[model samples]
Target chain A: MNSAETALFGLPWWQAFVGGICTIAIFSFLYKENPFYRFFEHLYIGIATGIGVMATINTFLWPTVLKPMVGADRIPFPDGTYAEPYNEFYLLYLIPIAFGSLYYFILSRKHNWLAQLVIGFTLGYGGGLAFKATFNEMLPQLEDSFRPLYVAQQGAQSGIDWLATLSNLVFLFTLLTALSYFFFTFRRSEGGPAEKSALAGRWMMMGCFGAFFGATIMARMALLVERLEFLINKWFPLFFA
Target chain B: MDSSARQKDSLAERLERIDRRVVYLLIALALSLPIIFGWKLPPAEMETADSFFRVVDELQPQQGKIVLIASDWGPGTQAENKPQTMIAMEHLMRKRIPFALISITPYAAPFLESMPRDIKEKLEAETPGETWNYGTDWINFGYRPGLIIMIQGLAKASDLHEVLKTDVSGTPLADLSIMDGVHTIRDISMLMEFTGLVSAFNYWVQFFQADGYRPPFVHGCTSITIPEAYIYYVSKQIVGLYEGVAGAAWYETLLTKKYPGRESGTALKINTSLAVAHVVIIALMILGNIGFLVRRGDS
Candidate 1:
C-alpha cells in the first residue's frame, strides 16, 4: 500500500487525527499561552525522556555490558535468527560494577572522600586529554592564519592576483586589530594609533556578530518552516484531501 | 486630548505596541501558505556545498575505501540534521561506497540506525534488482561514550575491528562483509560529520584529522554553527561544509542532476518556506524600527 492507504504507527486514520491535534495544540501558543500548548509540551518532554532511557538501555547497556556479561543463549535478531553464545567471564565485569558503585558514597558524610577520589581521577584524565586536544585543535587554525598577501601566477592567465592579495591583507588586518582590541596592558592616548586600531576592531567584531545573528535567524526560521510543512503537507491532507 | 494629537499618538503608539500574537500569526501564515500550495524555490548552490559534492563525487565504490560518518544529532535538531544525514546517506549508498556510522551522543544512536535504514529501504524500493544488504553495504557502531577519547581511540587504533568490537545489533564487527578490508583509520577515504553541535566537529578535527591523520573531512552543521565552521574550512582542516537546510537542498539538487528523476523532497519545500519566512521577518524588523524612529522624532 502507498503512504495514503497505509496507517502510520498502525492506527489508520487515528494517527493522522491525533498528529493534527497535537500540531495545532502546540502551535496554539501563537495566540497566547494556553493549557493545550502546555499539555503537548509536557507530553513531548516526557515521551522524549522515556524513549531516551529505554534506547540507552537497549542499545548501549545491553550490548556493551549486560549481554556481554550474562552471555545470552539466544541473540535477539531483528530477522528472528537465533545464535548461540556460551556463558563465560561474567564475573570479570563485576570489578568495574563494584568500583562504579563507590559513586554512591557521596551521599554519606564520612565516606564522601571515596567519591572524591573517583571525581579527582576523572578530572585529571579529562584535563590530560584536554591538554593534548587543545594543542591539536588550535595549532592548525593558528598555522593557517599565516596567509601570504601576494601570490605569483602559476598557470592562470589572470593578471596581478589582486583579489588573493586583498583577501589575505584583509584577513591579516582583521586578526591584528581584533587582537589589539583585547589588549588591556596600558591605556593608549585618546587619538593614538592604538586607539584607532582598537576602534576599527570593535566595528569589525560588530560586523562578525551581525553575520552570526543573521545566520541564527535563518536557522530558527528553518525550524518554523519545517513544523509548518509537517502540519500543512503531512497532517492537514488527511482530512482535507 | 485633541483629535489630531490623538491620531498621532494612536498611529505611532499602536505601531510600537502591536501585539506579538499578530506578528506570530503573520509568520505562521507566511510559512504555511507556500507549503500548502506547493510552491517551489530553488536554493542557490553554496561554494561550500559544491566543494562537499565534489569530494563525495570523487569516491569510487568497493575499492576498500570506507567513509566514517560521525552522527551527533538528536530530535531537537531533526529538521536540519535529519535532512543532512539522509542526503549524505543517499549519496553514499548511490555511489555504492562502504561506510560505517558511529554516534558520540547517546540520544543520537536510534537516529543513526533508523535514518540510514529508512533511506536504504527507500532506495531499494526505487531501484529494481539493486541490493543493499546490511552486512555488505553499511554498519552502525551505535553510541559510544567518552566523546573526545572515543574518537582518539578510533584514530590511534591499529585495528578498527578490535576497537569497535561489535555493531549496534551485538554482532561482532569481524562478521560483517563490509568490514573485510576496513581494519584501521587508514582505510577510511573520507570522514563526514553531521552535527548540530559545532564542538563535535572540533573533537573530530582535533583528535582525528589534525593530528597528522589526514583523511579528507567534511562537515554538515546547523546554520547557527556554520559561521564558526567556516574557519576550519578556510584553514583546510575540512574540505567542505554544509550549512543547514539550504545546504541540504543544494545537495539534493546536485544529486538529482547526477541521477535524473530523483524526487525533490522535504528540503526543497522547506527551503521555499524559509525564504518566505525570512522576508516576513525582515519586513517586520524594518517596520518595527521605523516605528521606533518615528516615536523618537516626535519626542
Candidate 2:
C-alpha cells in the first residue's frame, strides 16, 4: 500500500466516496436525465447558498457592521479607553442597514415600492460610476486606435520596420471596418460606401464570434479533462486493490 | 420480400444520425484514456506567457508596496483559473514579494483562503528554511460583495488601511507588519487579476486608478475569456496576459527553464488531455460535415 493512500489528508475516507457519487450523479445527465442528477443539482444549490450566506455573515457582517454597532469589536485599554478600531458613530450603520433591508420588501405585494426605492438608488449610483468609468476605460483605447501609418527607424536603423508597420495597418483596417458596422441607418440594399464598410464589419464580427467559440470549446474541454483526471486518479482508486 | 424490404443503410444516413450517447462516450474516452495511461505533450512556449513572466520577474519587492492579486475565480473556472492563480501566486512567493488576495465575488472566498495556504505549504517544504508565515508574507482581504462600488471606493479613499481595516479574519490590518507600509492605492506595485468573469476585469481597468498612478496590470483569464482579454492587452490596459491552462503550462515551462529541477506542475498534463480532446472533437466535426454533404447529395 502506498503511504499516501494510508492517510487521506485528515479528510475522512467517506469524503472521496461522496464526492465521487456527486460527480457521477452530475455526469449521469450525459446518458439521459435522471432523478439522481435532479437531486444532486438541488443539493448543490442548497449547499452553495448555505455556504455563501454563512461566509458573508462570518466575514463581512459580523466583523464589519454588527461587531462595531454592538461594541463586540471594542477592546478596552487598561484605563478603559477604547483600544479597538471602532467609533461611537457606528450606530449610524443602522440607517444603511435599514435601507438595504428594504430589499426583502420584494416579497411584499403592496410594499414592493420600498424595494424599488433601494433599487433605483443603487442603479443611479452604478450609472454615474459607469459614465465616469466608460470614459476612463475607453479613451486610452481610442487613443491607441490612432496608429502611426509610418514607422520611423531609430538608433542606427535606416528603413521602415515592416513587421510593426504591417501590424498597425491591420489594426487600422479592423477598427474602421468593425466600427462602421454600427451605422444602423445605412441600408444593406443601397450598396453605398456604408454598405461596403458594414459588410466588412459583419465579416469581422463573425471572425470574433468564431474565435470566441473556439476558445470556449477549449475551455470546456479543459474542465472535462480535469474532472476525468479526478475520477481516474482519486475516485476510481478507492475500488481497486 | 425480406431482401427488398431490408435495403442496406448508406454511410451518409448512418453517420448523419449518430446517437448522441455514442459521441459522449467517445469524448469521455478521448479525455480519460490519456490520463489513465501516461501520455503527455510538452507545453508550447507562448509570447503572452513570456510577457506575463517578464512583468512579474521585473517587479522588486518595495516597502510600502505590494502586489494586489484579484483572485476573482470560483468553482466554475477552477480547472483553468486554479492552476493560473497557483502559478502566479507561486511566482510572487518565490520572488519573496508580499502580496494580498482580494475577491469581489462571494464564490471566490474559499479559494482566497485555500490556494495561498497550499502554495505557502508547498513552497516552504520544497525550499528549506524559507518562512512563509501569514501576515508577514501575504494577507487575505476576504470576500467583498459590492463589486464596482467597492473598487471605486477603494481607489478614492486616501487611506487603504482605514478603508480596508481588517484581514479575512477579524484581525486588524494595522497589526499586520505588511500593512504598515501600505496606506493608499498608490502603494500597490501591480495588479494581477485571475478571473473568468469579463466584468470583473472591466471594473479593475475602469476604476483601479487614482492620481494618474495606475499600477502595471496583468491578467490570467480562463480560455473562454482569452479573446476579450486580448483586446485589453492590445489596448495596453493589461500589461501581460496568460490564457487558461495552456498559458499556465507555458508559465510553468518558463519557471522550469529559469530554475532547473523545480518540481513541475500538472498544467502540462491537463493541457495534453485538452489537446487530445480537441483533436477528437475536430475529427468528429469533419465527419459530421461530410455526412451532411453526402446526405444532401442523396436527397
Candidate 3:
C-alpha cells in the first residue's frame, strides 16, 4: 500500500496513535491522579454532551417539529432537492411539548399547576401505554408461566437436550426461592430447608452477578480497545514500540 | 512466610495469600500482551446467543414485514451498542424490509437523529443508479425526551403524525409512504430495543402490551445490567435477549451468515478482543478466588 494508505489504515499511524495516547493518558489516573488526564476526560465528556445535544436537535426537532410546523418547504437542503410543501395543522401539536418544557422553569419557582400540566400529560400518555403493554405482553407471559415441567416432541434432532430441561428447572427453582427469600409478609423459620433453599437462591443470584460483572468488564475493555485503535491506527503510528 | 509456620495453619490459611498489587500487574500484562502482539482468539456461540440468532433467522424476507429497531444508545455505549445496531440495520437493509429507527435515550441522538434524511443523502452519494427513496424504504422518528411518555404515545396511536412531525429536522412522518398505513407501535412486526437501561424494556412491556400491542419484542442491553433481563426472559417478558459484547458477537455471526462480506473485518477484530478479554477476566477471577482461599487457610 502507498504511504498515504498506510498512514490511513496502519497502526503506528496518526489517529490510532493519538487515540492510544489519549486512552493511556486517561488510564494513567488509575495509577496516580494527574491534571492532564482529568483535562482530557472532561474534554471527552463535554464533546460527547455537545454532540448529543446538536445531533438530537438536528434529527428529532427539525423533522418532527420545525418541518411539519413550518411546512417542509422552509427547511433548506444543500441542492434544494427536498423541498416538499406540507400541511399546516401539524404546527398545533407543538403546544403541549412546549408547555412540557416549561416544567423545568417551575423547579426554581414553585407554581404547582404549571408543572402539573406537563406531568399530567406525560403520566397520562405513559400510563396509558404502560397499561396497554402490560396486558398485551404480560398476560400472555403469566399464562406461559404454567408450562409443563418437561415436554417431549417426536423426532427431536438432539436426543433429550438435558441443558434445556436443567436450565428450565434451575430457572424455576431460582425464581421461586428468590421470591420466597423476599417474602416479607410473614416470618420464616430460622434454619429450615426453606431458609436453606432461599440461601441457595441467593448464591445463584450471586453467581449470575459474577457472570454479569465479567461481561461488563469485557464491554468496558472493548471500548478501551476501540479508542486505542482510533489513536494507534488512525492518530499516531510512530509510538507502536 | 516460613513453611513450618504455614504447615501449622489450615489449608484455607495457607491459601489466603498474595497482595492485590501483584494481581494488578499480572492483569495489566495479560491484557497488554494480546494487544501488543496482535493475538486474536476465535469466539464460540453460546446457547443464549444461538437462540438470539434463531429468532433473527426466522425473520427472513419471506415474512414481508420489517422489524422496528429502537436505538436509544449513543456514544457512551457506542462501543457495545454500535456494532449490534449496525448489524441489525444491515440485516434489515439486506432483507428488503423497510425498518424504522427511533430513540428515547437523551444521549443517543447523534447516530440516528438525522438518519432518515441522511440515509437518503448517503444513498444518493454512494449508489445513484439503483432506485431508492426515503419514506418508502426507511423512516427515522427523531429523538424524543420523556422516555416513558414517548413510548406511551407510540402505544395508543395518539398523535402518530404529530409524534413523527416533531422530528429534529422538520421532516414530517407523513411524507413517507411506508409510514402511511402505520398509526401505532403494534402495526410493526417486531420491536427490538437496544438500550443501556432495563427501564426501557420494562416501560415497553408495561405500556405497550397493556395497550393491545402484540408485536414480539427483543432486547439488547449493556452486559452489567443484563442478568435481571435474563430473569425477565425466563419469565418471558422479552422474546430474546442479547447482552453486551457477546450478544454483539452473536449478532455479527448471524449477519455474516446472511451477508458474507459486509463489514466482517471489523466484526472479527471485535470478536477477537472480546475473547481475549473474557479469558483475562476469568483468569483474574480464578486468581482472586485462589488468593481468598489462601488467606483463609492462613487465618
Candidate 4:
C-alpha cells in the first residue's frame, strides 16, 4: 500500500503535515530549549505511553489471559461443547493475576511489604533464569574462543592455514589481554608481564571503543539524515507536489 | 610583536571556537546536498552483509517451514532498522518464502504492518501483478508480552496454531494461507531478528533455542550494538549479521547487483549522506586540531 492507502493513520497528506510539524518541533531544541520542543516531547511521551498501555492490554493480556478465563476464545457448539475445550486450568491464570496485582500495593503506604513479596518472587525467578541464560549465551562464545592455532585445511599435509591460524592467534591474544585487564584485584609490578598484558588490553579496548564511538556517530548521523530526508522527500512534497 | 597583531581575528581563531549551530548547519548541508542533487551511490558491500544476504537468499521454501522475522524496532531506530527490515523482507518476498512477524516490543506493532506494506508497494511498483498481500504472503504475530517468556513459550509450544491462535488483526492463524504447515519452532526455516535493543537480542540467543534446534539465526542490529552483536556472529550463534544501516546498504547493493534496473532503496542514499557528513565532520575536526596546535605554539 502507498502513502495514499496508509490513510488509516490519517489523511495521506495530513499525516505528513503533522509529522513534519512534530519533527521540526523536536528539532527546535538544537537552537535552544524552547516550548516547541518541550510540548512535542511531552506529547510524544504521552502518546507513546498510551499506546504501550493499550497494546499491552489489548494485544497481550486480553488474548493471553482474560479471553482464556472468560471463554471468549472458545468456540461453542449448539449442544454447548467447545471446539477447543476450555480447560479449568485456565482459572490458574488468576493465581498470576493476583500475584501481579500486588505490584499496585507499592502505591500503598502501609501495605508496601505486600508488593515486596511478589517483587522478591519475581527477582528470584528472574535471577535463577539469568544464571542459565548467561551460561547459554556465554558457553558458545567461550567455545568459539578456543580455535585451533593451526587449522590444516584441504589435507593435513597440504600445510597449515596461516591466515586462519593468524586470525585465531589474534583472537586469543585479544581474549587473554581483555580478560587480564579486568583482573583489578591482582597486584603487578611496573613493566611486569601482567602489567604489560593489562596495558595491551586497555589499548585493544580503546580501539574497540573507538569503533563503537564511530558507529554511534554514524547511527546519529543516519537519524539526522532520515529527518532531513523526510523534510525533503515526504514533507516538502506535501506542499509542492 | 604588537598586542594588536597578537589579538588578531584570524581564521585559526574562528576554527578554534566556531559556533555549534554553524557546525550543525554545515553537517546538515553536507548530508542534504548529495541527496538533493542525487549523487547517492551504493556503498561497497561488506563481507558480513554479503553473508546476511546469502543466508536469506539461500532460503528455499519447504513444506512445514517458513522464516520467522522479528521486526523488533520502533521509530527511534527507524533510520537503521527500517532499511534492514526492508532489505530482509524484500529478499524473503522475492524468494516467495512465507514469513511471520513477531516482536517483543510494543513499539514494533505498527512496523509489523507498515514495513510489509512498504515492501509490497516497492515490489508492486517494480513488477506489476506480483503484489504481497497479507494473510498469504506474511502474517503479523504482533507484540508478545515478556521477551524471555514469549520466546520460551514459542519454544515449548507443541502446536503453534493453537498457541498463536490469531494474528495481530484478530484473524485466526488457521485462516491465513501463510500459516499452513507452520506448526512449531522446528518449522521455522530461519529466525531473523532486527532490533536496536541488545537485551532483546540477548533473549533470542538465550531463550529462542528450542529443544536444541536453533534454526539458522540471523541478526540485524543497530550501530550502537554492532560491536556486541559480532560476538554472536563470530561464535556461530547467528549465521549472519547486518551491522547497521551500513550493513543494510551493502546488502541492498548486492540485491541491486542481482536485479538491476529496479528503483534503488533509501539505505544507499542515507548511507551516502552519512559518508558526506563523515567527511564534513573529519574536516571540522582537523581544522579544530590545527587551530588548537597553532594557539598552543603562539602561547
Candidate 5:
C-alpha cells in the first residue's frame, strides 16, 4: 500500500475498531439506555465540535483572513500553481463571525448588546427571505392546483376523461378538506352541512396522515438498511478478511 | 391465581406472538440474499426520477464551468448517500464534467474524502482508458459548519476561489485548475445536492431562490425525506429529485444505460433489499392487524 493507504490504516487498530463499535453502540441506545452509549454519544459530539471549529478556521477564516493579509500571491501546490491575487471582501465575513460569537455573551450583562446586531441582521434577512420564498414556492403550486380535473394529450381522447377527472376531483377534495380540518374557530358551529363536511375533512386528514406516516416509515427503513449494509459490507468484510 | 400472575401470563403471551429478533432475522435475509446473488429489478420510472434524469442529461458539461455538488450527508447516512455521491460523480466524470463539492454539515468531511476516492478508483479499475483524475477534474471544499451563512456567503461572493481558499485536499483553491472559469454561484450552470436531511434542500430553495438566482437544481435526498421534498418538486423549486435507495438505483440504471460497463452493482443490491423490506413490512402490518382483531374478539 502507498503512504496514503498506510496512513489511513496507520491509525491505532483499537481506535478504529472502537470508533466503528461506538457507532453501533450509540445506535443500540434506540433499544435501551446505558452508560456506554451515553459516553460515546457525548464524545462524538465533543470531537465533532472541535473538528468542525478547526475545519471552519482552516477552510474559511484562514484563507479568507490570514492568508490574504500575510501570505503572498504564491503558495505551494501539488501541481505548483501560485495563489491568485487576494480580494478584500473575503475579510468582511469576519464581522458576521465575530458578531455570531457574541451569542455566548448573553450571560454577561455588559457585552450582551453586541449579540443583537448579529441577531437583528439575521432576523431581518430571514424575514425578507421567508416572505420572498413563501410566495415563490406556494404561488406556483396554488396555480397548478386549479387544473380542470383532466388533461388532454395530442390526438387522444385523454382530455377530461372520467377516471382522470375522478382522481383530480379526489385530489382537490383531499387538499381542501385537510386544510378545513385545521379550522379551529368554526369548531363550535353545528350546521348540518358544516358538520358533514367537517367529518369528511377529518377522514381526509387521517388518510393524509396515514400516507405521511407510511412514507416516513419506509424512508426510515431505507436509511436503516443502508447503515446495516455499510457495517456488514464495508466494515465487517474487511475486518474478517 | 394472583392478579400479578395473570399480568405475567398476558405479557408472556404477547412476547410469544412472534419474537422481534425473528423479524430482524427476516429483514436481514431479505436484504442480503438478492444482493449476494447480484439481482437486478425492472425499473419503475417515477416522474420525479424522470425529471431528475432529464435535468442531469440536459446540462452542457463542457460549457458549464463547474458542477456544484452539495455533499451534506455524513457516514451515519453513507448507506444511501454514498451510492448517490458515486452515481453523481460518475455521471459528471462520463460527461467530462469538472465539478467542485461543498459540504454544509460537519460530519460530511470524512465521507467526502472517502467517496470521491472510491469512485475515482472504481472508474479507473472498471474503465482503464477512462481515467478520472482527482484535484484537477474534481475538487471538494470539505465541510463548513454554518450552513445558512456559508451558503449565503457563497451566493453573494463574486469569487469563490478567493473566498473559500482551499479545496478538501488542503491545496489552495486558487491553485486548483478546476476553479479557473468559476467565480460565483451565478457562474454555475447546474447544482446537484445529495442530502440526508430535507431541510438542507429546503434551505437551498429558500435562500438560493430568494436571491433571484435559480439554476437547474436537482436533488438526491433520503427516502423518508422525498414526500416533503416532492412538494418542492411539484412546486418547481427544484428541477428534479431522487428519493433514497430507489432513487439511487434509478439513477444507477440511468448511468449504466448511458455509460455501459460501469461498476453499478451497488444500486441494484440496495434496491433488492428495499423490495424485500417492503414485502416484509406489509406482511407485518397485516399480521399486527390480525393480532389486534383476534385479541378484541377473544376479550
Candidate 6:
C-alpha cells in the first residue's frame, strides 16, 4: 500500500475525533431529537448557505457580469486613438439587473405592480421554454413508444433478442393500459372492458410506484452506508483500528 | 394463561409495540458492521453499466475529442454521484482523454473542484510513468447560472472560448491545450451528465440533443430519478445511464474486469452494506405485517 493510502486510512487523530463527534451528533436523531443534533444541523445549513452565496458571487457574477463590464479592453480606432479601456456598451448589462431588482418591489403595497412585471416576464419566458422542452423531450419518447409487436427473423437471432421482444410487448401493453387509467372522460360499468383495462392500469401503476419506492429506499440506504463507512473505516480507524 | 399462550401473546404484542429507536439502531448496526468488518462482495455486471463503459472505452485519447462532464449534483447526492464521477474521471485519466467539467448548479462547483486532485493522486499511484496535466488533460469551468440558457449558449456559440473566456481558476481558455479543437457543442465527442435532478437531464436533452447538436449523452442519476430516467433510456435519448450506487458498483466491476488489479472501491462496499441494510428493513416490514395480522385476529 502507498503512503497516501495509509494516510487516507489513518486520518489524523483530531480529525477523526471531530468526525466521530459530528457523526454521533447527526445519528443522535435515532435516539431522539437532541440539542447536539440541532446545533450541528443549523451549523451545516449556515455553512452551506454561506458557501452557496460566495460561490455564486465569485464563480458566476464576478466572472460573467462584473469582470466583463469593468475589465473590457479598448479597441484602437483608425486614427490610432484609444477610447476608455472598459467598453461603454457594457453598461447595458445593468438593464437586466435593474429589472431583476424590481422583484424586491413585491414588499410594497402600492408599487407591487413593478414586481408583477418581473414575475410576468419570468413566467412568460419560463412557459415558452417549458413548451419547447415538452416538445423536444417528450416527442422523441412518444415516438419510441411505438414498439414492434412481432420479432423479425434477423432481429431474433438470439434468445435475448426474443426476450427483448416479449419485454417490448409487455411495455406496449402497460403503456396503453396506463393511458387508459388516466382517461377519465368516460365512465365505465364494473364489468366493462374499459373498467377492466383501467384496473390493470392501476395495478401496473402500483408496480411502478413500488419500484420507485424501493429505489428511494436503496438511495437513502446508500447515503446512510456512506456516512457509516466514513465513521467506521475512516474515523474510528484512527483510534480503534 | 398457560406459559406457551403467554409467550405467543407477547410475541405478537411486542413486535407491534417495538420502539422506533430499536429499528433505527438495527439499521445503523447493519450498515456499520459490514464496513467495520471489511466485508466485500462481487458486483454483478449490468447492461446499463456495460453500455456506459463501452462508450468511454471506445473513445480514442489525445485526438482533440473531448467529453463534456455536466456535473449537476451537490453534497446531498455525494454518496452516489461522487463515486460515479470518480470512476469516470479515473477512466478518462487512464485513457488520457481530455475533458471539460462544467456545473450549472450553485453547489456543484466546490464539490467538483476536489475531483481533479483525487483523480491525479489515483492516476499517479496506479500508473507510475503516466502523467496527466490539468490544462492539457482537463479543465474546470466552475459554475454557470442558467441551465437552459447555458445549454443553448453551448449549442449556439460560434466560439466556445469567446463564450467562456476563463475557466474556474481565471485561466484563459485559449491557453489550455485541451481546448485545441473544442470550439462549439459540435466539437464535443460526448457528454456525461451526473445529476441529482430530472429537470437537468430534461434540459440537457431539450437544448443539447433535440436542438440539433446531438452528441452521445450519458446520464448518471440518483436512484430516485432512475424510474423517470428509464423513459429516456427506452427512448434512446441517453445512450447510457448509471442508476445510483448499484449502477456505480456495476461500473466498478466492469472496470476491474477490464483492468485487473484495480481496487474495488467504495461502491462495492456500499453495495454490500446496502444489501444487508435492505434485508434488515425487509425483515422489519415482514415482522410488522405479521404483528398487524395477529392483532387483527385478536380484535
Residue-wise lDDT of candidate 2 within B1-299, one digit each (tens)?
A: 25422332266656767889998888888888778886878888888888999999999888889999999888878889988988889999889899999998788998999988988888877888987979988999989867887888788889898888899887889899988879888889999999989999899999999988788999999999999999888888988898889999999989878877578777878888888888888988888888778767555
Q: Looking at every candidate separately, what fraction of the true A–B Cα contacts under 8 Å does it contain?
A: 0.73, 0.77, 0.46, 0.76, 0.45, 0.79
Candidate 6: where is the Cα deviation over 4 Å? A1-20, A72-84, A153-162, A238-241, B1-3, B295-299
DockQ for candidate 4, please give it: 0.74
In angstroms, the error of model 1 at A228 is 1.6
TM-score of 1: 0.90
Model 1 misplacement above 4 A: A1-9, A12-23, A73-90, B1-9, B209-211
Tens-digit lDDT track for model 3 on A77-194?
7986556666667778777667978687667556766777787877886677667666755675667666556644447474555666676777678778877777677666889877
Summarize candidate 6's per-residue lDDT along A128-238 as a digit string, tens digits: 988988888889899998888776556436434677688898998899899999988887888999999999999999999999999999888887887887787767667
lDDT of 5 by residue, B69-163 (tens): 89888766777777777887777776778888888887788777777778788778987676777767788888866676677677778787766
lDDT head-to-head 2 vs 4, winner? 4
lDDT of 4 at B172: 88
Task: Show pairs that collide, candidate 1.
Answer: none
Tens digit of lDDT per residue, candidate 1, span A1-241? 7775765445847766787788789878877799989999999889888876777787666766786677662567787655754556765888877777788899999999888877887899889988988888788899999888786555867566887889889999999999989999999889999999999999989999999999898888777777777777667677667
| lDDT on C-alpha atoms for all candidate structures | 0.83, 0.86, 0.65, 0.88, 0.73, 0.84
What TM-score would chain A of each candidate receive against the reference chain A? 0.82, 0.87, 0.73, 0.87, 0.75, 0.83
- Give the winner by DockQ: 4
Better of 1 and 6 by TM-score: 6
lDDT value, residue B246 of candidate 1: 88
Q: Which ten residues in a row have the lowest lDDT in candidate 6 chain A?
A: A152-161
Collision pairs in model 4: none
Return the DockQ of model 5: 0.43
Q: Between 4 and 5, whose lDDT is larger?
A: 4
- Candidate order (DockQ): 4, 2, 6, 1, 5, 3
DockQ of the candidate models in sequence: 0.60, 0.72, 0.35, 0.74, 0.43, 0.70
* lDDT tens readout by residue for model 1, B1-299: 68976787678777777789888888888888788798889888799999999999998886666899988887667788888888988899988998888888777887877887887788887897998878778888888876787888889888888888888887888788898888777888899998888788888888884346669999998888888989888988899888888899899899999988666667887788888888988888887777777778777
Model 3 chain B is weakest, by summed lDDT over 10 consecutive residues, at: B10-19
